[model samples]
Target: MKLSLVIPCYNESANLPLLLDRCMALDSGSDIEVILVDNGSTDKSLEVLSKLLPRYSNCRTVRVETNQGYGFGILSGLRAARGDIMGWTHADMQTDPQDARKGLELFDRHGDGIFVKGRRYGRPIMDVVFTVGMSAFETLLLARSMWDINAQPTMFSRRFFETWQSPPHDFSLDLYAYYQAKIHGLKVHRFPVRFGERAHGVSHWNVNWAAKWKFIRRTVDFSLQLKKSMMVVNI
Candidate 1:
């Protein structure tokens, strides 16, 4: 089965060449296509992509003229994907884009009735603690054991994706997809992946406590709404 991996780029101009190099190894094969999304980047990202994309046959670009949220960019790529198996990873190069290959293997062995994600290692102690705290909160609050909620290379079959009713259009999209997999009884598979430093540019969030608090506030609000929706579904 063909696999499509979407990497959403938002002003990731410096990271593009390195990211594409890493992707070149995976995208060389026709079975795996890499979709590099220019998610309304104000920098020279589109120009860089234009010059670079033609060199790789298995990779292509999708342009979103207006920068929407992270999830909107991913959704844009996903909607344009041509693979039977589809998923997304980060463009920051913090998480290796090649890791998606392992996710593809999970589908090859387990079949399409599963959801696959990475479990990050090699993060700083505070980041790990933060992740653990958030994991606990989401698990307890949503009644689903959601760990490493924002880890990269989240993969599933197109059929599983088609079942999504209204996936979020922000970072919470990670939580939304993971929770959906749990509630839908998809066999969850986890693989270890190294979480490294960004190749370039500061994070849009996660810069400091204030940024993290905003992320948390947004996530908690979405989680509550998701919980209420689940309750309604049960009713």
Candidate 2:
């Protein structure tokens, strides 16, 4: 089966070249395409991408004229994807692209009704705090358990996307995606993966109470809808 890797990039010109090189080095067979979604970067990201596109035969870049948030870029890339299995990773290269092969292997074995998600390690203090808090809130809201909901390098079959509908065009998309998977009774296998600090850029989260509350509300709403849908399906 073919694999599509979606990378959402925002002002990531400094890291794109190295990220692309590492991604291209992965041994995920020959049927892999890397889709780089530029989220209206003001930096030289597009110029750098243009220059490097010719060097990698399996890599393609698309530029969004306006900043459409993280999940919006993911949706755009998914719409453009042409593979049986699709997944996403950040452009910062914090998560190794080689780990993607492990996810693909899991998919190859149990992908018919499973979503392979990565569990992250080596986060900074603030990130650890944010992730732990978010995980607790998500578990409470969904009445289900998830490890590292914000982990990068999540892989899902194209069937999951086709069945669940389009994801939210906002930061809460991951929560919604996971909730949908659970409601549909899809098996989610979390694989341990290493996370590294950004080699060039800084993170955007401020890790305040407001962010936590916003995430909680979004997760609650998604969970309610998913529960109702699953009940109807069961009936």
Candidate 3:
């Protein structure tokens, strides 16, 4: 099966080269395409990508003039993907691309399921606090159990996107996608994977009280909307 690796980047020029190299080493056993979605970076990220394009036959870059949110960059790559299996990772190299080989093996063995999400390890204190707070809030709001909903190395079948409705355009998009998949009776498996801190650029997340409140509000609204939609269909 053709495989596509989508890397969503924003001002991640420092880590792009290493990320590309790691990805190119995956044992996909089929044609592999690496799609780099540049999310309106002001740095020399685009130029760096241009230089690397000639080095790899399957590497391509898609540039967005405006700074769309993280989810938008992922959506852009998904739209342009030409592979049977679709996977995505952060451009910061926090998650190793080599883990992708294991993901592919799981997919091959399990046939088609919902998605394979990586469970993070060795998160910083701030990251732990944010993740715990968000997970608790989402659990309370959605009445569902989840682990690592914000994990980076997420892999799924390309068919998942064919019927996926528009997700939120913010950091919570990952949570939204998880809930939507569950609502559709899709199976989601969590795989233990290694996680490292960002190799270069600083994070863009806000871990304050305001961010917490906003997350709570969005989770409740989206959960209720999904429940209402299901009821309407049942009626």
**Per-prediction TM-score to the true structure, in the order listed:** 0.98, 0.87, 0.87
lDDT of 3 by residue, 4-26 (tens): 88888899898888888887777
CA lDDT, candidate 2, residue 58:
80
lDDT of each: 0.93, 0.80, 0.77
Q: Give the top-scoring candidate (TM-score).
A: 1
Q: Pick the candidate with the highest lDDT.
A: 1
Candidate 1 off by > 4 Å = none
Q: Which stretches of candidate 3 lie over 4 Å from their true place?
A: 27-29, 206-235
Q: Write the per-residue lDDT of candidate 2 for residues 1-235, one digit (tens) a residue.
A: 3888888999999998898898788634668888999988899998999988899878887779898788898888987999788888888777887787888888788755788788998777777887887788667756788668878687788888898665677766777778778877888988888888787887554356686677667666766776676678879
What are the per-residue Cα lDDT tens digits for candidate 1 across 145-208?
9999999889999999999988889999999999999999999999999999999999988899
TM-score of 1: 0.98
Candidate 2 vs 3: which has more lDDT? 2
Q: Tell me how candidate 3 scores on lDDT.
A: 0.77
Quote model 3's TM-score: 0.87
